[model samples]
Target: MLSGLLMIVDMQNDFVTKNGSLYFPQAEKVKPVVIDIVKDRMKREYDLIFTKDWHDPNDLEFKRFPVHCIKETYGAEIFDDLKFIIRDYSKINFVMKKRFSAFYGTNFDDILKNLSPKHVEICGVDTNICVMYTVEELKNRDYDVVIYENGVASYDEKLHEFAISQMRDVLGAKIEKWRSFNAQH
Candidate 1:
């Protein structure tokens, strides 16, 4: 069993629900897939980490969008059943990242070092920004990044497609789909 961490990024209500500050159609579509990945990934005993975009309702970050994903609100909560699905009695490092990079302002790097992960599979919402940003961070540190394309959800199909391309072309990461990864990796 190779040491690996599944980075589930910003698949919360603020980005999934229609009323979200920056909702994307594909994100909602991929919600079930993300949950399934989390469930299955946990059974493998691999490190499961989620990067939440818990923003202040009136933060300047929302100036581009609006107030959403405030703490304890529906938007802030992980997508439905995502909570019930992953049985974590042991506070499994669910960090809240204020910026696009999960590495910033959080103990993400420290946690990964503890896990000592050799490979990272990043899946979540907002493809172009957070996903791309985090992938680059991991690459800079020479981590093998496996990006689950369908496992991630994004706003704007153009951005989503281009994001994947960017990872493959620029980052030298493996690009795979959810179904492909589900086929007994």
Candidate 2:
């Protein structure tokens, strides 16, 4: 039985690619690592779940950050490289989120409940923001959350490290390098 879920958070063009409006410097570098993790997990008893920031044109979040990931726009789409691997949406679930945390204003909680995963591994961009919030929420829901250190990135290096530490120490999440985690699974 598939009791593990791999959550790829905000690996969309706006956060992970150069052409995006809110692209992070190290975001592109984590792509290959995230892809490798995905491929490896696909070969295991783990299901894939991708979360994208599908914001409304007039979303309130625009006041905090630059306008990006507007619905139906290229910025909101998943990176081209990752899109190819999603050959079947039925097997790979996609969750469109409007806020920083995937659990807010989305059916993410319901989906997580339905899947009933024993563990959830998270990977993606802006480690200090979206990824951090998601981790906090997942932990609050009592899920065993694992963060792939090498597969996630942040524009600010210090904040990235801090977020990882917070998730590991405060939220009680397991932090591991993608290669190390993949090797075990």
Candidate lDDT scores, in order, read: 0.81, 0.88
- Write model 2 residue lDDT over 1-185, tens digit each, in one string: 43989999899998888879999779867999988988778777477889999988999989989999998999999899889876654557888988889988888888888888999999998899999999999999899999989999999999999999999999999999878444666
Q: What is candidate 1's lDDT per residue for 52-152, written digit by digit as tens?
A: 88777677787776776787678887776787777653536788877889898889889888888889988887889989999989999999999988888
Top candidate when judged by lDDT against the true structure: 2
Q: After superposition on all CA atoms, how large is the RMSD of candidate 1?
A: 2.2
In terms of lDDT, the poorest run of 10 residues in model 2 is: 176-185
Best by TM-score: 2
Look at candidate 1 and tell me the lDDT of residue 111: 87
TM-score for each predicted model, relative to the true structure: 0.90, 0.94
